[model samples]
Target chain A: MRLFHGQRAWVLQRLTALVVLLLLALTAATLLIGPAPSYERWHALATSAPGAVLIVIFFAALCGHAWVGVRDIVLDYIQPTALRLPLLALIAFILIAITLRVTLTMATHFTVGA
Target chain B: MPAPPRAAPKFLNLAQIRFPIGAIASIGHRISGVLLLISLPFLVLALERSLRSEADYAALGTWLNSPWRALLLVVMVWAATHHLLAGVRHMLMDIGIGSRLAQARMSAWSTIVAALLIALLAAMRWLS
Candidate 1:
């Protein structure tokens, strides 16, 4: 048998969820241990590859998950499929744009001064 | 009499539940969404506090375990589980795991059970 329900979207959601959980665990651990890291320490941590990867993956997954959820909400209550579809599209566009923007900001940390 | 018109029923057939598993799931998901919406500000404030200083962080730690905090935590727990369960349902639909009526019913029940178990644990943690 397949390891999962075998749908691509479902698998993607679960995979994203697993990534989110792992990231959240790391976040909780870091916070619970201490919140007094110096600005340089925190900045270094954020600029690290593992941190960047975690953050990018997190934003990506969060956008996808929230888009799916909001789309479902539209479907359930919008009453008109035509309207629902466009609303979902708009939401997807906005989420994707914002995520890309944030990712770009994260990318700036390692760059040499302009 | 040629015709008779009576008052329309005030309640939806949905309000009358013979078998309400699907409706229950839908309701739970919506409720979770609403709870998450309400709790977002509190959580954000907590997040902001924890980022400010050690004392602020300690305050958040204490706040997270308070009675109102526990209630909000339960809401978040419900939201997380409901959303997760709904995601699994979508996944199952895609994989053809439970297209049959019986199997779908079983899956729905499983979601509820799993959600309840998670909620119980989260509540316990909050209380403890």
Candidate 2:
């Protein structure tokens, strides 16, 4: 069985990387030019439609990009397939948890006051 | 007929290997990726806390104002900037750009410089 065909994953990694790059640039610019890091400013930004959308997209892309990168490292260093597979699974689980937490928090917070 | 067994050669010491700037940058890319992965949990917690309530957000702000947090932020910023620049270089290489040895080396150095500069800026912003 072919367990690790990485062409698709490679393409997705690059694509998601591109998206993340753009989003990060926007975020950095906002941080530099907008108000300081305070509760009001953060809440305002996170509750906005564009900000919410961007946050969701960024986190999702981040999860994909990170998974591909960490999986490659694991494949390169870990010789034992058993160990590598479980480790990869763990990474995936953690990323999923992060995505869920961020998304849910944003959703609940944004919708409550709107 | 049985094939002849291969003889094992002497193991080379890691210290003997000379890493060029490009190789160093490549290794830094991997290291930065690992650093960001490890820091993700903290980042997520910070985000959650900031969004939880006004008091939690103020607490996060206070925590971020601390010297220890400043140091952690610097390291994280450096990791993120380095990872980003290296990722762009990798993307360029994927597109058949900067594939030459000299060009690759130049880009790698540029990535390091750019990352450092960004991290310095972030440090200044965080401290002030």
Candidate 3:
């Protein structure tokens, strides 16, 4: 799927946005009714299988949504191809790196706890 | 050869150009999205740190509670709340709700106000 171009990017942005919004609402609900915040509780939740997986999904959707959103801004404002292309590349690289790092962190914690 | 059409005169003064309410909300969406995008790394770092260990989690909390970091957190909260509320408006408009000029303006104003209120609440929560 041409994930980053034309109509696909637009669709992807909306879909990821929906995903992020739902996840955020779920998080807020949990925090509101669940036990008060503490390090042990936070750590335990992060290491739980369902929590870890959902967190991973949340970050994935968030980063993807951000990619399209930022791309739109860069395209609108940065007219020079030379500057814009490199800036876009840099943004993409940083986002990809962040996604990987979150995944890795979650994976390590999950495995270590298991 | 036919003469080429002349370009329209451009009004390039940003300060002089008055943005409508909808336009202000629309630009706020873009600006907040950029702010959130730039803040992603810090979010990830917080996640990583909080999950590392009990001590690390406490350290991260303490770090965030510092005056400057707390201020930055408030800014991030504003960015997030504004982006999320404005995004919901966009989605609603996509589904043909509030697409009329009057409704759109009203929704835009509500989104901006709600976002600020939420941000203010967040700040109060943090401070308390």
Candidate 4:
């Protein structure tokens, strides 16, 4: 089928959204269902096959979705070309920073400990 | 007759009757997404604190109970609920369940109702 650029973006956004929603629910449940684990236990859960996978997926989807949605918001509300572009860039940088910080810390923690 | 009968006007109450539900929902969706994104690091920090030790967890509870944290949680819930209601609307549209003009309008109203309900629930939880 012939799909427009916006349509493709819309599909990706929705799929990412579903992933985020499910992951958020799971994360909240995990946090609430069990007693708060120690740093070692928490680290183990996070770096385990399932937890690590979920975190990676959640971060990836969240960053992409937030970047696109926030970019559009800035474009729509902020009329200035120079300011708009820079703010959009800032949002992109924020997403990348979040991904990198979480990933690197998780990686280091897992590798050093495990 | 004074003149040929004029056609009925389109708007009964243009400003009040007409609403851009999709646009409103879309904007809210985006706003919530951004809020969740920006607030995430602090929550993560709180998690880290809570994981360190029991005293640290108690301190985290104290920090979380502050007015600032309350406000932040309120924002989070608001964003989460809005996104959720709008998401259901999208799902219905994708399934071709609300394609008709009448159905679409009703669906829009449903979105609004859902959003308000969510906000009210969030406020109750936050205030309590």
Candidate 1 stretches with Cα past 4 Å from truth are A1-47, A79-114, B1-12, B17-19, B37-57
Report the error of model 4 at residue B35, Å: 2.4
For residues B37-90, could you state the per-residue lDDT of candidate 1 as single tens digits?
445435434534444455775665566657887877776887878766865685
Off by over 4 Å in 2: A112-114, B1-7, B121-128
Q: List native contact recovery per candidate, as a fraction of 1.
A: 0.00, 1.00, 0.94, 0.28
Question: Which model scores highest in TM-score?
Answer: 3
Sorted by lDDT (best first), the order is 3, 2, 4, 1
Supply the TM-score for candidate 2.
0.88
lDDT of 1 at A99: 67
Instruction: Find the 10 residues in a row with the least total lDDT in model 4 chain B.
Output: B43-52
Candidate 4, B6-113: lDDT as tens digits: 874565675586557666667677777677777767755664554456588567656646667776677677777777777777777888988777877777777767
Candidate 3 TM-score over all chains jointly: 0.90
| Candidate 2 clashing pairs, residues 3+ apart or interchain | none
Error of 2 at A31 (Å): 3.6
lDDT by residue for model 3 over B11-125, one digit each (tens)? 7998899889999999999989989988889889889888877898778767767777787788888889899999999999999999999999999999999888888987887
**TM-score of each model, paired residue for residue:** 0.60, 0.88, 0.90, 0.73
Best by DockQ: 3
- Residue pairs in collision within model 3: none
User: What CA root-mean-square deviation does each model show from the true structure?
Assistant: 7.6, 2.7, 2.7, 6.6
CA lDDT, every model vs. true structure: 0.66, 0.86, 0.87, 0.71
lDDT of 2 by residue, A41-79 (tens): 778888777777788888888888999999899988998
